[model samples]
Target: MLGLLSESEAREVEQVVAAYPEIKSELNAMEDALTQYAVAKGIPMPADLPGRIIRRLETLDKDVPPGSTTPPQTDSGSGPILPILGFLLITALAGAIYFWFQTDELQENLNTTQTELQQLQVNCDQIQDSLEQIVLSLAVLRSEGNQTFIMRGLPDKNPGAVANVYYNTQAQQAFLDIRELPPPPAGQQYQLWGIGASGVPQSMDVFNIPQGDGINFIPVPYLADVSVFAVSLEPAGGSPSPTDVHMISG
Candidate 1:
């Protein structure tokens, strides 16, 4: 139909396609069908086919000889078709959908980022809890007339064991710091003793470090004028006096 028209007639045809919505819709639907068909049949469609089709249609629709529906070839196939933004849009859409399906790297990256964020949140919460515990302990360790007593392991039993006693000498209030120790059986616990200046070993408190942990904290009975601090393995309820299995003393 364009070939039957004069040069001026063809330019008029290109203008209509570039400026009209009806024409653009028709062009869009044609390519959409072609893409769907190619994918359904497991066939690869040339990436540039949509652009080429629009260019061809733009040229062929430029002019129509009254009641004539045929193309007329000229020196250049349909003299200078309009620049087709519709084809560019279709091309971009196709590329986006392809990447969304065929690329897992993007999804994997998103999942990894979420997992790391969760871990960081958990670590932050743990640090906050640890800070709260430290503040509580520091209040006692820094009280008026605070004194520290070190306990060393007994010569015959767990000589490697050690501890620190943080006590308020004035108030006789104390806390036990079991720094390094072995875990006893489920039915056995370790006991702390405060040996008075009178040389009498008084049971202070019962405690345990689960799973042979390196450290534990226990609130101890008042220890006014205590001359020694000691740790001994005792039955679950604890012994009334230092046990024969004393693990540490000072």
Candidate 2:
């Protein structure tokens, strides 16, 4: 009992407790001292002291084996589980990153493919338009044996402009060939007219020609006794009637 112990013994026990690296190892000895001290003093044990001794004993028991004083098993399988779980976590994280990069690459490729497809579609449309123009040009050249009229631009209005008219009398088709003209201003276009025997101009077709390379071929379904061919400047899509005389090749 601590109370029964001489002052030197009590001091010695305290010194031993202080000398130990782990305070948890002194719980049993501390409890023994408290019990002997309470009995020797003819006093009941303090309520707080039992609870404190139990808590300290529990802490020491976690690190010390039962029946023997050797330290408890430190390997609770936690070390192995941690490393394995960490490896699995890292693997999952890497897989997610790889998938993200792969998805981005696929999306970029898809966008590129879509752009190329759109350009191809535009090229196809242009090729189709050119083919139609070629077919019309061939039809006009085949009618070369028919009555051909050379309509020179009016020297006063357009000195450098020239055009040709091919009339297939057998087929009753008129083909117009404008060889020289200036480019129309923005929002304006050129229209062709057939002047008949009665001097009345009939609406024929509308076309646009680039500067320097001013040739255009247009086919007319109906051919009457046309004496002259003319051209006029109209709106972008042409008008029901000529707006102004830009160039007349007749």
TM-score of each candidate? Answer: 0.48, 0.55
Candidate lDDT (C-alpha), each = 0.65, 0.61
- Candidate 2 at 234: error in angstroms? 5.1
Q: What are the root-mean-square deviations of the candidates from the true structure over C-alphas?
A: 11.9, 23.9
Worst 10 residues of 1 by lDDT: 79-88
Candidate 2 residue runs with Cα over 4 Å from true position: 1-81, 186-189, 205-216, 234-250
**Quick one: best TM-score, which candidate?**
2
Model 1 lDDT tens row, 1-250:
2222346644544444445546556656756775786677555556676676566575545643345423333456663243343344444445654564345456667888999999999999977866775776778777899888888777677777778888787877888877766677788888888777788888887876634332335677886778777787888989988666555444
Which residue ranges in model 1 land beyond 4 Å of their true spot?
Answer: 1-108, 129-141, 185-187, 197-202, 210-217, 221-227, 236-242, 247-250
For this target, which candidate reaches the highest lDDT against the unseen true structure? 1
Q: Give the Cα error of residue 227 in candidate 2, in Å.
A: 3.0
Give Cα distance to truth, residue 232, candidate 2, Å.
3.0
